[model samples]
Target chain A: MRITIIGSGNVATHLAAAFKNGGHRIVQVYSREIQNAALLAYHVKAEAIDRLQDIDPETDLFVIAVKDDAIFSLGLSLAPYKKLTVHTSGATALTVLSSIMPNSGVLYPLQTLSKNKEVDFLNVPLCIEGPDEQTTRILEQLAQTISNKVYRINSAQRKVLHLAAVFACNFPNYLYEVARRLLDKQNIDFELIRPLILETAQKVQENLPVEVQTGPAVRNDENTMKMHLQMLQDEPGLQMIYELLSQGIIKNTKDGH
Target chain B: MRITIIGSGNVATHLAAAFKNGGHRIVQVYSREIQNAALLAYHVKAEAIDRLQDIDPETDLFVIAVKDDAIFSLGLSLAPYKKLTVHTSGATALTVLSSIMPNSGVLYPLQTLSKNKEVDFLNVPLCIEGPDEQTTRILEQLAQTISNKVYRINSAQRKVLHLAAVFACNFPNYLYEVARRLLDKQNIDFELIRPLILETAQKVQENLPVEVQTGPAVRNDENTMKMHLQMLQDEPGLQMIYELLSQGIIKNTKDGH
Candidate 1:
């Protein structure tokens, strides 16, 4: 399969390499900046293009791996290709791309991507969606070649998954930052909490997160909660977050969710 | 050193086993219920006692491993011993025990402890505090016998560390529970997000969390944030949490935190 990757960002670089490594032909790489395109294109043995007119119309697939807001506008350039165009976004709906391209689909990788950090795509779940049965099947086949887990998720379900990913991945990383800052102020080493963070995530692999949840909030230990709140009094932002999340945990536990 | 473990809960059980494994003599295990005490005592080859009168006053140290609220009352019951009594609590002040026992100190382990889950004491940071330098040194020596990391943290510093732990470990686990529920409602397997969660935590091991954070919130992508808010309208509690955390993340990013 010949593929043209649009965008020179993290997702674009990762997908380009994965496809090439999986024995698919990456025919071209595109970016507004030619240098950015050439950097990734050099490794995949593909042509790099800065101009929209230079895109190869003969490729079997066009993957728009740009930012969430840029997907629709950048996708407009690919309408002339009339190929199966897919966007690698979790938040954007399939209809957004399908509206411009008749053979549009979604090949969203359900994992965080970083340019410097290499990920094993085989374990990442590929959430696929298409406008028609045949298109969906073709996307699934391609997805299976790169990933072991593939799911046919509709637009509405995909939106919810994207929201959940923010909570599961993004919010926790911010909380870790907060923890690091708090310890930094006290001259405590941030490495002290790395094991706890790793073990907390590892526990979820074998058990439901709710079942393994521990801390003052889950145990309803008011004394510790009060002390924590008192300690964060100077930092109103952290205090507000602490209160809201603790209440959420209590409510969820009471509701048996 | 001869150690008497008061309370047979998660912390007590782990500490008892670690102390025994470090070649120290565990004098006794104490609990309100005889069965609870006997269960842990059998593993450490120590006597089990339910009554305060049965506690051996000759022991070198008495480690109080009860709940936060119970620590005060339980410590009063053993006031006759007048030994170096220490409570393994994060939120409670070191002065709380020092006020009751003249030779009190703190032997707080800065890690989450679960009875069924075995943890290596060598990596767990043992925070020690005492009324005097000699007692602090004694606790530090005992901590060093089982763990490599030991620090002399005061009550105020320990309280802050505990608060940071809540944000790093407890709050992240709650967010994971929220993600699990959202995916469960859509019939999506929660296993799909496990790799993301692990990688998110793993990133912190090599880089500062603030430098490595990624998501709509950190990027200030209002479009994705607005869509997420709209999707979470029905669940007001979750929506409120989402708004507060996102706002906090944006504020932190803008403030160059």
Candidate 2:
């Protein structure tokens, strides 16, 4: 299948490469900045185009892999082709494409993708959403070629998943930075806590996150909690984060499992 | 070397087993409940003693692996032994043991330990802090026997690490639970986000977490963030967490690197 990729960001680059590696032809890569598109295109062995009008007309599928805001305009531009069109966005709704194109869907890869780091595409969960049955099946088949884990998720579920991804990936990452900052204050190398972070994440792989939760909060170690809050006295933001999250853990743990 | 483990919780059990495997004899395992002590003792081929009075006189080292508040009282009880004593606590100061014993230190294993789950003891980072050089070296030597990674940390630094651990391990876990709850509302399985969690952690192993931070917060995707905040409107607590953490990421990212 001939695929044309729009945008040149991390998600776009990763998806484009995965598609190419899965035996699909990347007809052209599009970016507002032609050089950016060219860089990605060079890796996938595809043509690079600066304008949407220059997108390959011979493309079998056009993937609008741009930011959420850019997806509507890009989708509008590609609607004329009537080729199977999809956008790799978790937040954008299928309705954004449903009215414009008869064959429209979403191929949302639910993982943090970075262009510099290579991820095992097969392990990345692909959330596929489509305007209709055939389009959904097509996206799933396309996704399965590149990834082992693919689910036919609806627009609502995709949105929920995206929001959840923020908590699971983004927010936790922020917490890690907070941890780094805390250690930095004491001149302790952040590397010391790296193993603990890795093991914590690894635990959730086999066990439920809630079931395997451990901390001063869960254990109700008030003295330690008091000392921690005192340590963060100067920074009320961190103190609040510590208090709220600790309370949340205690409440959640006590509520049920 | 003969070691007696005080407290039969996760740390005590794991440490006792590790010490035994490292060619040190675990002379006794002590807990408030004899059954708990006996259970751990059975695993490590040691005697079970519930009372402090029954602490083996022949023990070379006494390891107190109880809760933070319990450390002082337990240390006081074992003060007469005057053996090279240590507590496996990140929060409690070494003074708790120093006043009680001539040779006191800390052998804090900085990984989340659960009795049900077997951890790779070799990968667990042992943070050792001793009152004197001699005691520090002894603990370091003992720590080296069970784990490949060991660090000489002072009380202040250990406390900082403990606080950091809350941010790195505990708080991130609560966020994971938040993600799970969000998915649960939509009847989606929590398993889907597990890979993202794992990869997020794996990324930090090679890259500074702040360097690899990715999300709407870092990307400054106002549109998606708005949608997310709206989605979480009913739950004000979660809404606040979303806003603050996102703001934190935005602020932190912009500050430096």
Number of the top candidate by TM-score? 2
lDDT of 1 at A178: 90
**Model 1 lDDT per residue over B1-257, tens place:** 99999999888999999999999999999999999999999999999999988888879889999889998887787777888889999888988877887888899888877777788888888999989999999899889998998889999888878888899998999999989989999998898889989988887888778777778898799999998998888988888888888987898899996
**Candidate 2 — which residues are off by over 4 angstroms?**
none
Q: Taking chain A by itself, what TM-score does each prediction score?
A: 0.96, 0.97
User: What digit string (tens of lDDT, one per residue) describes model 1 on residues A1-257?
Assistant: 99999999888998898899889999999999999999999999999999998888889999999889999988787877789999989999998889887999998888877777778889888899999999999999999888888889888888888899999999998999899889989988898888889888877877778777777897799989987888888998889889989998888789986
Restricted to chain B, the TM-score per model reads 0.95, 0.97
DockQ, per-model, please?
A: 0.73, 0.87
Scored by lDDT, the top model is 2
TM-score of 1: 0.94
Give residue B61's error in model 2 in angstroms: 0.9
Q: Judged by lDDT against the true structure, how good is candidate 1?
A: 0.89
